[model samples]
Target: MSINLEGFVRRKTKLKLGGKEWIFNELSLADFARLRAKMAKERKVNLAERRKQLIEEAKGIGDIDPLKLLEHLDKPVTDEEMDAEMESIEGVGYMAYLSLKYAYPEVTEEDALKMLSIDKIEVVVGAMMGGLSGDKKKPKAKAKPV
Candidate 1:
């Protein structure tokens, strides 16, 4: 017997932070493939090495200008936002990385930092993986003839 899957194409959730509301669209297989390709191209290292490098880089920098890491993101950043501080830029980057698309109107750098203070890029990535895993269907077991 085949399991019928309907109405499972897109999933959306709302997130509230710093008196602002944001919508998150569940990632699809295509999104995962894109993310994997982006990461492979940007990091060019294994996961363990990448983690170590990230930690080392963070420790090495006294004042990190997040805009410098804009190349790591899948989306383009405007020149105006490029001058913003690290936290805000990272927040926007993290959100954009996980979601299909997002927009924030008149979002001040300070506001973005405040809104995304508790969110970690790693967590968003893990959530994306989990969402993808949940979408997969388990293999059906074969029936034994009597």
Candidate 2:
């Protein structure tokens, strides 16, 4: 029997953070490849090593005059504005980076945080794997005439 592998399609969903909403697309194959590469680059010996690296990274993040990292993640927080609140919005940035990636638009950190849910990572992973596996139902075969 010939294999049919044509049901996979990318999906998009609406995500609301704080008071704002944005469209988040399911991870494409290309996006998964990129994520894999990024993870490889960021891998550490252990959780402790990863934490130490993140702490050092945060110090460099603080030295910047503007919150460029947030901007890179398509977040709207500016250095001047963030300075007033002095809040660390890295979690929100990470969510956006993973979910939206290059298509992420400017969103406030507060709004982004509001959109984040505990199950978001699981949902994204599910979506990614679902896309890979083609979860849609296949058509039933017809019986030949007796």
Candidate 3:
């Protein structure tokens, strides 16, 4: 004879199982269904939604093709929007940006114009490390200046 275990579950109460009497917390039927639906919706959007929002906001300031944005999708990004799609890498510096620009000639001021569209602000974070924070690591001292 086949039995449906779900029928045995108490709506919102705890369930004790087996000879050892192991107990597990169970949510109310409504709450369980609601939580499952919410999780599914969240999983559907999450990162992709943030990327789209960031691209939309960036485009608002000027004209840009979403496809061009796709070229740099897998690349590092600047957090210049409400969605804050990209994160600030802790140890990156100005030299790193210059090196990156030097390495990838395609990442020009024009690309910056497309991404952030801020000419005076110059290169984006990936291009020039966004002009490093004022805080700097202390320089090592010379041994015995005497």
Assess every candidate by TM-score: 0.35, 0.36, 0.19
Over the stretch 19-94, how does candidate 1's per-residue lDDT look in tens digits? Answer: 7566556656666455445544554445456555655686689576444543454244443433342135553454
Q: With candidate 3 superimposed using the best TM-score fit, by how many Å does residue 66's alpha carbon deviate from the native? A: 1.8
Candidate 3 to native Cα RMSD, angstroms: 24.0
lDDT scores of the candidates, listed in order: 0.49, 0.48, 0.37
Q: lDDT tens digits, residues 41-120, model 2?
A: 44322444645555667677786533343334333344454333312344334444555543465655454455666555
- Residue-wise lDDT of candidate 3 within 42-73, one digit each (tens)? 54556587678768876896777766775654
- Top-lDDT structure, candidate number: 1
lDDT: the better of candidates 1 and 2: 1
What are the per-model numbers of colliding residue pairs?
0, 1, 0
